[model samples]
Structure formats: structure tokens, C-alpha cells
Target: MNIKLLAVGKTDNESLQKLIDEYIKRLGFYINFNLEILPDIKNAKNLSEAQQKEKEGELILKKIQSADVLILLDEKGKQYTSEEFSGYLQKKMNSGAKQLVFVIGGPYGFSDEVYKKSSGKISLSKMTFSHQMVRLFFVEQLYRGFTILRNEPYHHR
Candidate 1:
């Protein structure tokens, strides 16, 4: 199954971008993985937190396909061990899914609509992280998961 990561905004730090790129390249060896960035909203000052979430939610929902399995990266979501996450990814692939998409929502988090649309949520950590930083962390873990799946040395490194 194809795996896609959709996140709001771009990663601006050169150092972070380098690391994210490395993980993305590594992940590509295992699956059809693509990291898509949605442009950040401009002049967000006028929008309330909920309104921002709603707007971002709409954008997030639009990127999804009817058959795609949607997963959200949420702080309050189910947290999994690395092995469990690997198994989860394996199950989705085994089920013959066309595509599996994971989204990292904007600052205020997801709207109710987005929550309803998702099949599941995976939390990387209980602590909060910057939206941009989460992209790197998520991509790196994805690479690690794939490595473990293949019994590669990278996972242990």
C-alpha cells in the first residue's frame, strides 16, 4: 500500500529539512511514501483557534481519497510501541489497501469533521511537539518501522 504523510505548512529549518529528507529517502525503499505539505494559512491572526482548525480540517479532508485509510497523529490518541506500530502497518498492507494516509494537523489540532473521517490515531509521544518538528519525528519513526520490518541494521543504529 502507498503511504502518504500530509502535514500543514513546510519545514523551514535547513538542518531539520536535511534530516527529514534523509528519512524520506530511506522510507522510499520500503514503500511508496510521499510527504505532502499543505501551505500554511496567512494572516491567521483573525481566525479563532477553532476556526483555524475547521479551515485546516477542510484542507486535510480534501487530500483524502474515498478508499484511503486515514490516520491522524494526535496527542490524545492511542500510543503504540514500535513493534505494535510495525504490525499495524503490516496489517494495513496485508488488507490490500490502495493507500494509507497519515496527517499532522495544524497548531490548534483537528476539527470534529477530521476526527470523524479518520480510521485511527497514533500518538508519537504524550508530550507536545511543534507541528513542524512532528513531521521530522514522524518520518524518522516511519523509517525505523520499515527498517524493523525488513530486519535491517538501521533500526538498531
Candidate 2:
């Protein structure tokens, strides 16, 4: 199955982008992966939080294919251990899914409409993280998860 990571805005920090790219490349060794960036909504000083989310939601929806399994990276979603997350990845492939779409919402979070369209949600941690930082963390963890699944030296029990 193909894995697509959808996030709003761009990663401006070069160091963080490097780390994200490294993990993304490592992840490619195990599975098909794509990192998609939705341009940040312009002139956000006027738009309310709800309206911003709504606009971002529209942009997010536009990238999705009909058969994609949408998974939101929500703060309130269930958390899993590295090993468990590997299983989650394995199950998706076993189920013959075409694409697994993982989304990181905008600063204010996702719209109700986006929530309605998702199949599930996952929280990386209980603590909050910047959207930019989360990209690094999520990509690294995804690489770590795949390594764990393949018995690679990157992860330890």
C-alpha cells in the first residue's frame, strides 16, 4: 500500500526538513511513501479559526483519492507503542488498501467536515507539538516503526 502524509503549510527550517527527508527516504525502503504539502492559507489575519480550518480542509480534501484511508493526526486520538504502530502499518498492507493517508492539520486544527471524512485518528503523544516539529517526529517514528517490523538495527526492544 502507498502511504501519503498530508500536512498544511511548509517546513521552513532547513535542519528539520533535512531530518524529515532522511526518515522519509529510509521509509521508502520498506513501503511506498509520499509527503504532500498544502500551501498555507494566505492572509490569515482576517479569517477566524473555524474559517481557517474550513479553508484548509478544502485544500486537504482536494489531494485525497477516493480509495484512500484517511487518518488524522489528532491530539485526542489513541496513542500506540512503536511495535503496535508497526502492526497498524502491517494491517493496512495486509488489508490490500490502495493508499493510507495520514494528515497533520493546520495550527488551529481540522474542520468538522474533515473529521467526518477520516477513517481513524492517531495521536503521537499527549503533549502538544508545533506542526513543523511534528513532521520530523512523525516521519522518524514511521521509519522506526518499519525498522521494528523488519528486525532492523535502528530500533531496540
Candidate 3:
């Protein structure tokens, strides 16, 4: 199955972008992967928190196909161990999904519409993280998951 990561805004920090790129490249060896960055909302300063999430949600929904499995990276979502996450990845692959779309929403998080459309939600940690930083962390974890699946030496356990 193809894995796509859709996130709002660009990773402006050169160092973070470089690391995110490296993990994306590593992920390509195991499966089809793509990182699509949705441009940040314009005039966001004037919009309310709800308005911003709504606009960002629209852009996110536009990219999703009906058949794609949408997973949101939400703080209140389910948390799993590394091994368990690998199992989750295996199950998605086994289910024969055409594409697994994971989204990292904008500053105010997702809208009600976006929440309704999601197949499930995953929490990387209980602590909050910057949207840009989450991109890197998620990709690195994805790479680690694949390595665990393949019994590669990349993951210690």
C-alpha cells in the first residue's frame, strides 16, 4: 500500500527538513511513500481558531480520495509501542488499502469534518509537539516501523 503524509505548511528549518528528507528516502526502500505539504492558510492572523482549522481541513479533505484510509495524528488518539505500531502497519498492508493518508493538521488542530472522515487516529506521544517537528518524528518512526517489520538492525528491540 502507498503511504502518504499530508501536513500543513513547510518545514522552514533547514536542519529539520534535511532529517525529514532522509527518513522519507529510507521509507521508499520498504514501500511507496510520499510527503505532500499543503500551503499554510493566508491571512491566518485575522481568522479565528475555528476558522483556521476549517480552512485547513478543507485543503486536507481535498487531497483525500474516498478510498484512501485517513489517519489523523492527534494528541488524544490511541498510542502504541513500536512493535505494536509495526503490527498496525502490517494490518493496513494486509487489508489491501490503496493508500494510507496520515495527516498532521494546522496550529489549531483538525475540524469536526476532518475528524468525522478519519478512519482512525494515532498519538505519537502524550506531550504536544510543533507541527514541523512532528513531521520529522513521524517519518523517523515510520522508517523504524518498517525496519522492525523486516527484522533489520535499525531498531534495537
Candidate 4:
């Protein structure tokens, strides 16, 4: 199955970009992984948080295909151990999911509409991280999950 990561805005830090790129390249060896970055909304300063989320939600929805299983990287979402996450990935692959799209929303988070459209959510941590930082963290976890699935020595018990 193809795995796609859709996130709002760009990762401006060169150091962070390098790490994210490394994981993306590593992931390509295991699956058809693609990272799609949605442009940050212009004139966002004038819009209220709700307005921004609504606009961002609209853009997010447009990127999703009918058959895609969309999952949000949300704080309120389900948390899983590395092994459990590997099992979750295996389950999706076994079910023949065409595309697994995981989204990292904008600064203020997702809208009600986006929430309703998602298949599920996965939380990386209970503590919050910057939007750019989350991209790197999520990709690393994804790489770790795949390695665990392959019985590699990357993940420790």
C-alpha cells in the first residue's frame, strides 16, 4: 500500500529538513511513500483561528481521494506502542488499503469537518510539538514501525 503524509506548511529548518528527508528516503525502500506539503494560507494573520481551520480543512479534504484512508496526527488520537503500531500497519497492508494518508494539521489544529472525514487518528505523544517538528517525528516513527515489521534491530523493547 502507498503511504502519504500530508502536512500544512513547509519545514523551514535545514537541519529538520535533512532528518525528514532521510526518513522519507528510508521509507521508500519499504513502501510507496510520498510527502505532500500543502502551502500555508496567506493572510492568515487576519483570519480567526476558526476561520483558518475551516479554510485549511477545505484544502485538506480536497487532497483526499475517495478510497484513501485518512488519519490525522492528533493529540487526542489513539496512542500505540511501537510493536502495536507495527501491527496496525500490518493490518492496513493486509486489508489492501490503496493509500494511507496521515495528516498533520495547521497551527490551530483541525476543523470539525476534517475530524468527521478522517478514518482514525494516531497520537505521537501527549505533549505538543511544533508542526514542523511533528513531521520529522512522525516519519521516524513510521520508519521504526516498518523496521519492526521486518524484524530489524532498529526498535528496542
Candidate 5:
């Protein structure tokens, strides 16, 4: 199955973007992976937190198709070990999902609409992370998950 990561705004840090790109490249060996960055909302300074989430949510929902499995990267979501995550991915692939879309919401987090649209949620950790950093972390974990599934040395190293 094809896997897609949808995140709001651009990753401005050169270091972070480089690392995120590296993991994306490695992930290509395992699955059709795409990282799509949605443009940031204009005039966001004038909007309330809820308004910003609503606007971001609209952009997020627009990218999703009815058949896509939507998973939100959220703090309050289910947490899993690396091996368990690999199993989770295996189940999705076996289930014959066309695409698994995971989202990293904007600074203020997701809107009610976005939450409602999600099929599930996953938490990398209980600790908070910058949205940009989360991009790197999530991709790296994805790469690691594949390596673990294949019994590659990358997981132990």
C-alpha cells in the first residue's frame, strides 16, 4: 500500500529537512511513500487558535479521499513500541488499503472536523515536539519499522 505523510507548513530548518529527506528516501525501498506539505494559512496572526485549526483542517481534509485510511499524529493517541508499530503497518498492508495517510497538524493542533475524519490516532511519545521535528521523527520511525520487519541490521544499530 502507498503511504503518505501530510503536514502543515514547510520545514524551515535545513538540518531537519535533510534528515527527513534521508528517511523518506530509505522508505522508498519498502513502499510508495509521499510527504506532502500543505501551505500555511495566510494572515494566521489575526485568527484565534480554533480558527487556525479549522483553516488547517480544511486543507487537510481536502487532500484525503473517501477510501484513504486517515491517521492523525496526536498526543492523546495510542502509543506503540517499534515492533508493534511494524505489526500495525503489516496489518494495514495485508488489509489491502490503497493509501495510509498520516497527518501532523499545525502548531495549535487539529480541529474537530479533522479529528472526526481520522480512522485512528498514534502518539510517538508523551513529550511534546516541534511540528517540524515530528516530521523527522515520524519518518525515521517509519524507516526503522520497515527495517525491523525485514530483519535488517538498521534496527539494532
Candidate 6:
């Protein structure tokens, strides 16, 4: 199965981008992983929080296909340990998921429509992190998850 990460805006910090790139390359060895960055909305200062989320939602939805399993990186979603997350990844592949799409929403969060469209949600941590930072964390965790599944030396109990 293909794994796609959909996030709004680019990572402006060079160091963070470098780390994110490293994980992306590592992930390629185990699975077909794609990172799609949707451009941030222009004139966002003029829009209300709800409107901004709505506009971002439209862009997010456009990238999703009918068969894709849409999962959001939401703050309130269920949390899992590294081993459990590896099991979750294995389950998706076993279930014949074509594409597993995990989205990191904009600064204001996701729209109601986006929430309704999501098949499930996952929380990386209880405390919030910047959207850009979340991309790196999520990608690295994904790589670690795959390593755990394959019995690689990358992860340890």
C-alpha cells in the first residue's frame, strides 16, 4: 500500500526540512511514500478561522481519491505506543488499503467537512506542536514503525 502525507504549507526552516527529507528517503526503502504539500492560502489574514479551515479543507479534499483511507493527525484522537503504531500500519496493509492518507491540518485546524470525511484520527502527543514540526515527527515515527515491523535495528523497546 502507498502512504501519503498531506500537509498545508512548506517547512521554512532548513534544518527541519533536512530531517523530514531524511525520513522520506528512509521510508521509500520500505513503502511507496509520498509527501504532498498544498500551498498555504493567500490573504489568510483576511479570513476568519472557520473560513480558513474551509479553504484549506477544499485543497486537502482535492488530493484524496475515493479509495484512499483518510486519517487526520488530530489532537483529540487516540494515542498509541511505537509498537502499537507498527501494528496499526501492518493492519492497514493487510486490509488491502490502496493509499493511507494522513493529514496535518493548518494552524487553525480542520473544517467540519474534513472531520466528517476522515476514516480515523491519530494523536501524536497531547501537547501541540507546530504544523511544520509535526511533519518531521510524523515521518520519523512512520519510518520507525516500519523498522519495528521488519525487525530492523532502528527501534528498541
Residue 133 CA displacement from its true place in model 5, Å = 0.5
Per-model TM-score versus the true fold: 0.97, 0.97, 0.98, 0.97, 0.98, 0.98
Global Cα lDDT for candidate 1: 0.91
Off by over 4 Å in 6: none
Taking all chains together, the TM-score of candidate 5 against the true structure is 0.98
Write one digit per residue (lDDT tens) for candidate 1, span 1-157. 8999999998889899999999998887889999999988777789999899989998999999999999999998899887788888889999999999999999888999999999999999999999879999999888888888888888777
lDDT of 5 by residue, 42-140 (tens): 999999999999999999999999999999999999999999999999999999899999999999989999999999999999999999999999999
Error of 4 at 138 (Å): 0.5
Q: Which stretches of candidate 4 lie over 4 Å from their true place?
A: none
| Model 4 agreement with the true structure over 46-118: per-residue lDDT tens digits | 9999999999999999999999999999999999998899999999999888999999999999999999999
Residue 137 lDDT in candidate 5:
93
Relative to the true structure, how large is the alpha-carbon lDDT of every model?
0.91, 0.93, 0.96, 0.95, 0.97, 0.96
Query: How does candidate 6 score on lDDT?
Result: 0.96
RMSD of each: 0.9, 1.0, 0.8, 1.0, 0.6, 0.9
Superior candidate under lDDT, 2 versus 4: 4
TM-score of 2: 0.97
Off by over 4 Å in 2: none
Clashing pairs in 5: none
Q: What is the overall TM-score of model 6 with all chains considered together?
A: 0.98
Clashes of each: 0, 0, 0, 0, 0, 0
Clashing pairs in 1: none
User: By summed lDDT, which 10 consecutive residues of candidate 4 come out lowest?
Assistant: 148-157
Better of 1 and 6 by lDDT: 6
**How does candidate 4 score on lDDT?**
0.95
